[model samples]
Each structure stands twice: as C-alpha cells, then as structure tokens.
Target: MFLVYVDESGDTGLVNSPSNYFCLSAIVVHESHWQTTLNSVIGFRKELRASYGFKLREEIHCSHFIHKPGDFQRIPKSLRLRLLRDVIDFQASLLNYQIVNMVVNKKNKSLNSDIFSLAWQTLIQRIENTLYHHNFIGSNNATDSALLFVDKTDEIKLRNLTRRMRRYNPVPNSFNLGSGYRMMPTQWVIEDAIHRDSAHSYFI
Candidate 1:
C-alpha cells in the first residue's frame, strides 16, 4: 500500500485573489517506508528545534512563515529563508518517495470557474497514472494500492469529486483514430479521501 499526503497552495477564488495560480501537491510514500519517513521527518524537526528554537509541534505554513505573521514574527526573515531551503534539501534527500504537483493558471479562467475541483481532478489523475505505472517500490513488480490523506479544506466537495472519479474517470486517448476519450476509473486508490487537519499532520 502507498500513503499519499496532499496539500494546496493559494486560494481557489479568482476575483480579488492575491495569487493567479492554485496548486495541489501530493507526496507518495510506500507503506514499507512510511515509518522510516516519519522518523526522518521527526529527526529533521528535532534538529530544527535544537538549532533554531523551532518548536516541534509548530506547523510550518510557508506563507505565514515567510510573511512573519503571528508567532513567526519572532523568527528572523533570513533564518526563515534558510529553514525553507533546509526543508527542500531534506525532502530531496528522502528515498522511496515521489512528489506530484498540479498548478492551475486562473488568468484565463472565468470568475465562476471551479478552480479547486479542476486542480484536484488534474492532480488526482496524475497521481492515479503514476500509481498505475509505478505502484510498487524497489524490485517488487506487483501492483500496489494507495490511500489519500488530504488536508481538510472542502471535505464534502473533495469527497464527492473523488467518489465520482472512482466511478467514471475518463482520459483522452491520443493514440486513437479520432478525438476520443477512454474510461479509466480509479482502480488503485481505495475509498474516499481521508481528511486530516494540517496542523496535526507534519507531512501535510
């Protein structure tokens, strides 16, 4: 089994929104490596605590940290930038993990466009494709399944979207004779996405 953790950046709103893009990112880790990955993360957090006075339980919200909002105001801007770079480096060093990201440019989209749903659909489709082709870790050729853990945002909407996709996901068949799409219902992802508060989940 694979454990997928998902999070989003930027608001879904288009009008008067500060950012023009909304992004969804997922980190995939095999069940066998979950514990090791968690341990590594905890170790990294501990190092942060010891070296920079960053609390272990403190959630690392990039925007808030960068903007020096609330408690983050106490930390130096230069140190925050360094910490962000450390995070990227640590993530890069992790083994048996894959990161998938989907960004929606809302510049061309209508104000009424459902940015959240569109971004999630594209992100989930990419994740499903990755699972289909490379489900297993290492030399194991047997296919594996995955469960998604998304940061709690729009639970009802996201759940409905995931459930619907599992039933009737269609993808364009580029190799077909004409403009055609094929049914590719999600088979490897099990059940609806389990929502978790990002505050509690360090991975989120």
Candidate 2:
C-alpha cells in the first residue's frame, strides 16, 4: 500500500474573513492507483477547458483563471458548480483512499500549535501508529515509504503567508506517520497543488 499525504494553503473560513484559520489536511491513497487518479484529474480539467470557452472559477489559483484582488466569489455559477463537480468526480475515479483533516488556527497558537505543522505531524504520527498496529503494509521485505503533496507557496507574491509556513517544524524523517508509537523514516512527497481541493480531490 502507498500513502499520499496532502496539505492546503489559504484561510479555511469564508474568503476575505479577518481570521487567520487555514485548513490543513492529510490523506492516504493507494500508491498503485495514485498516478491513475492524478492523471484523471489532469484530464478532467483539460477537457472542461477545451469544451467550455471560459475557464472554471475554483481554478482561482490557476494562472489562466485568476480572480481580481477584491473579488473571489464573483465567479459565474456554472463555472463554480463545474469546479465542485470536478472534485467529486476525482474521488469517484480513485480506486481507494482515506482522509484526515486538521484546521490550523494561525491567529493564536495558545490553543494549538501551527495548523500546517500539526497537519503534517498528524499524518505522520497517525499513519505510523496505524501501521504499527497492522504490521508492515505491502510485504515482509517492503520498506515504509510515504509521499506528501504540498501546494506551491507564494514567497514574493504571498510572502507573508508563505512565511507563516516557515514556522512549521522541519523533521528529518517526516516520511512515515508515527507508527505504533515509533518514528520510522519514510518517503514524503510535497506537491504544490495539494490544498483545500485535496479533501475533495481524494474524498471517500
């Protein structure tokens, strides 16, 4: 079995809200099927763009379809709905997957540490623990490996926000989630496109 950990950027609450709560989540998908699911997502979006003269709204981060500074929700209803549908279709297309969500309250660390860090750690810790309980995943000789997909961070453009991520704890072995109370080294993949769309991207 393969583990694909996911993370997100941007405030989880209503867009433009003053709060500093960004949503961070981690999910696991079968390695054997990860590439297939990813390719499907790429294909779906490409098809939509070719079929429709206009681009979808949720692709807000997409350079081809970015919203003005003050307008994020002003996107057309049809485009927005399509975006949602695409996410749903992505999960349906996946062979199998499991998701874990972590909401970071960046405003005050009093209640919790950084959410981004927590999200990453949680996935590591949780996955490791799960494995310890279930023995090695694939085979007797199989070594533990995990990949994390992180959405690209904006340094110059969104420097302040990306800077916040710098606060996240850097672990030498962030590959495996905490396994059976023991920390093991595993591969971690950090893909920039992994974000709020991830939950939707890999939903059950």
Candidate 2 regions exceeding 4 Å error are 1-5, 11-17, 54-75, 105-116, 134-143, 153-204
Q: Report how far off residue 90 is in candidate 1 (Å).
A: 0.8
User: lDDT tens digits, residues 1-204, model 1?
Assistant: 888899989889988999999998888888888888899999999999887788999988788887645887777888888888898999999888888889999999997899998998888888778778875453264578788999968989998988999889887887654688989888878888989998899889
Each prediction's RMSD over C-alphas, in Å, is 1.8, 8.8
- The clash numbers for all candidates, in the given order, read 0, 17
Name the weakest run of 10 consecutive residues (lDDT summed) in model 2.
186-195
Clashing pairs in 1: none
Predictions in order: lDDT: 0.86, 0.49
Residue 77 CA error for candidate 2 (Å)?
Answer: 2.6
Q: Write the per-residue lDDT of candidate 2 for residues 1-204, one digit (tens) a residue.
A: 555555565643443446676765566666676776667656666776665533433343432333342343545656755755665676565555666666666665554344544544545555555554544333332444444454543323333332333344344453576533432433332222233343244221
**lDDT for model 1, on a 0 to 1 scale?**
0.86
